[model samples]
Structure formats: C-alpha cells, structure tokens
Target: MSDVLRQWQALTASLPVKALGLAAWLLAMALVFGLLERRFPIRPQRFLRQRLAQDVGYYFLGGLVPPFLTVAATAALVWFASGLVPASFYAWVASLPFAVRVGAMVLLGDVAFYWAHRWSHENEWLWRMHAVHHSPTELDWLVNTRAHPLDLVFARAVSAVPIVVLGIRQGNDGLDAAVAVYLALTTLWAFFVHTNVRWHLGWLEQVVVTPAFHHWHHANLPGTLSRNYASLFPWIDRVFGTYHLPARQFPTTYGADRELPQTLGAQLASPFRKPPS
Candidate 1:
C-alpha cells in the first residue's frame, strides 16, 4: 500500500496526469449542472437539436483552445523580453508556496479578463469577432462553449499573455498549476452562470459574478446592451464603472441586437466578412 501511494504521488506531478484530473473535474461539473438546469431553469430557453450539435462541438473544442494562442503569445513575449527579464525572478516565483501562486493567478487572471471582455464590446474589429457569441438568442447551459474559435483564442491570449509574462518577469515555479486551477474554475463557473437555473443567490451577487449579472450583460434590453463587463469579480466592474447588477429582477430578453448568420460555418466565417450596413 505504501509503494502504491508513492507511485500515485509520482504520477500526480506529471503534467498530463494533472490535465486528465482537470478533465475529470470538468466532466463532473457538467453532470451536476446538467441535472440542476432541468430542475430549476431561471427562465425558459429554447434548445433545438441543431444548436445542441453546435454547442457540443464547441464544448469539446474549448478544451483545445487555450494552448494555441496562449502558447504563441508566451513564446513571443519570451523572445522579446529575454534580455530585459532577470532569470532569478522566475526562480524566486518557483520557490514560493503553492497557495500564494494560486492566489496571484486568480487575482491577476480576473483583472486581465475584465479588460479583455470590455474591449471586445468597444472595439469594432473585435466586436465583429465577438458578435458570434452574442448571436445565441438564449443562454443554454453550454452557451459558454458557443464562442467563435477566434474569439476564444483572442480572449484567451488576452487573459494569459500578461499572467505568464508576469511569471517570467518574476518566476514561474507554481504558475502552471495556478493557471490550470484558475482556468478550471473559470470554465466550470461559466456553465453555472449561463444555465437556466432559477438561482438568484441574493447577497452572493456582491462576492462574485452570478447568472443575474452575466444574464444582464447578455441582455438585449435598452439599459443592458453594454453594461456589466467583469468576467470573474463584480467588484472590478464596480471600480471601473461598468457594473450594472439589479438585485431582484432578471433580464427578460437576451442576444445581440445585430444580424448574425444562423449556420455555424457562416457564423465562423462572418467575422472575416464585411459587416451588414
């Protein structure tokens, strides 16, 4: 039994082993949330078979997204900063305790994503890319995965580049583990936030992003088109002045006000085409 335990500990340190563990956790979240949505849909939503196929494709594809753009950006950053960054800084970060590294990842990741999410709304080219996400007429529990690959790539690049660079600037012993844990939290919470669950977790709204807050962000209503930009923490929006949470009422409608192609391929291709006048 002791020898078996030692072998398990050794396997845990392997990156692929850690990845498989993350996958199992995500699958468990999906199963739990899938049941909850059926029992407590906050609002009625449409879920056609075609949409199911599209989203299922996205759900799997999302797992493959981060590494592409994030890795590229990390490589570019390293090439550019090699001369300026101190080698010892990364060594120091590697030496820190695990909990501290994870805390920094959450704090820094939220800040990075908040700005990226907000910019996707204001920037024309990016909005064109991001508009595919808002194209969903209603929020499915899996709506988190319905994002365009480019949009996912870009949002990911924005979130990762800074954190990894900071690690490189300082050190990165625990950075990989921290990022993995943060991404897992971010992905799982996304399902809950987009679910049809009737949860209005009252005061909890002040602590973190909730379906109420995110629902409003996607709301097509007059006061809601461009508000509530923070992805993880509500306080960040509160500080930056984009916060727009209403305690009791939820948005009655959702989706982008613009025209979007109905088919997945067209929607994917739409970003490259000229916008409708």
Candidate 2:
C-alpha cells in the first residue's frame, strides 16, 4: 500500500504547480474578503442577502462541476496530442534560448485569447453560452466559474491551439511552461477581479487588470456592457477603442433586465433557449 501510494504521488507530481498555487491564493482571498464584508457591511440589507445567496450558489457550482471537467478535458487533450506529435518537436522548442520561446507564447496566447473572448461576446448563440457567467446578480469572487462548460472548453481550446501550433513549429518545453504559468496566473486573476474586495492599485489598472476594473464589466447598466473586454491587459480594449471607465461609484445593479432562469439545470440549458425579444 505504501509503495502504491508513492507511485500515485509520483504520477500526480507532473501536474502543473500553478494550479495548486492558484488554489491557495483564492482561498486566502476568500478569507480576507469574507472578513471585510463582515466588517464594512454594504448597505441595503436586502441587496446584501441577494448577493450573498448568489455567491454561495456560485461557489457551490464551481466546487461541484466546472473545475473538474476543465482539468480532465485539458489533461486528456494534451495527453492525446502528445502521442501524435513528434517528441522532437517539443525537444526542438525546448532547445531554443528560453527568452524567445517565452516571448512568443505570451504574445501569441494573448492574441488568441483576445479573439476567442471577442467572439464569445459578438455571437449571440455563443453569448447565450457565455451568459451563464454574466447572469450573476452580484459581482464577486465566485462568479468567475459560472461560465458554461461549452464556452469554457471553446475558450481554452482556442487559447491553447496557438501554443500547440507553436510547439509543433518550434518544438519547446519552454512554451509549455510559459503557457502553464500564464494559465495559473490568469485563473487567479479572474478570481481576484471577480472578488468584492475594495483593494485598488490606482492607475495600475491601465497595465494589469484589477478587481475594480473587471467589476465594471459585470455591470448591467446600459452603457457599461460594451466596455472592458480585455482579460489580462487593458491596453487591448484601449487600442481597439472598446474601453469605458465608470465614474467614481460602482454600478448599483447586475444581470440582464430580462429574468434568466434560476435553476442550475435551466442555466445549463439556457444557451439553447430563445433570447429575449
């Protein structure tokens, strides 16, 4: 039994370290924010109850579903692709001086992710799938995982394809490492930006995406819907002329004006349901 346990540990050790690090970061943030909400206490008690309920639901769904599905799907796809691709391809990329591969993955990954994100918004059918994420009535840490499985799979597959294609072209472990680190950091940032904590880094929002910056994206107000699309960097939105900065106050409401179905099964099926006319 001890030997079997040791073998299992060795097999699991190959899992990305970033995923573990991100889990730790999210737990710490949740604790800090939970305490802050208790201390500061946002007004309108009814609103607080609603937001809290939604957050609880968010975490429940996150814990029960999406994470496991995503990990399993990604692991399987990578394993399958590994078998078909030449070992020499990965080896060649790995042999390149580290800086070149790192730079390539970062730029290419962001570009791929940018298009995938934009498409999720622009296509109504895809938006239906994406809307599960936007359906949260309150913006908070847990809202990050409310995405539909199809949207999640599509976005991840698109984001990864560029790196995989790069690996095929140049053959490198550095690309894999860079992608793993980026995925971990981006996942943590998604949670951080969704968090209710009031921490702000001021003008740093222009460079690194922050919680306050993304909270506005969840704003259901008329004009706010079209703004703040960039996932990691604000410059992409700015460069493309889609950026919109909210006034000093956060928006008072969230979710579409039309009532979305409340049940989890209903939400999963929502993408196929007719959109509000």
RMSD of each: 6.8, 6.0
Cα lDDT of model 2 by residue, 222-242, tens digit: 867667877888788788777
- Residues 1-277 of candidate 1 have per-residue lDDT tens digits of 3544554455445547556765686578667877787677776554453477777666655565445555555566656555666767767776777777677767777888888888898888888888877877777677877887778777777776556666632554555665667666787788778877778887889999998889888888886757887778899988888889876777778888688887877887887888868
Candidate 1 weakest ten by summed lDDT: 1-10
Clashing pairs in 1: 42-196, 89-170, 90-170, 90-171, 94-173
Residue 16 lDDT (model 1): 71
TM-scores for all candidates: the values are: 0.82, 0.72
Off by over 4 Å in 2: 1-29, 36-95, 168-178
Query: CA lDDT of each candidate?
Result: 0.74, 0.68
Clashing pairs in 2: 89-171, 93-171, 93-172, 94-172, 140-194
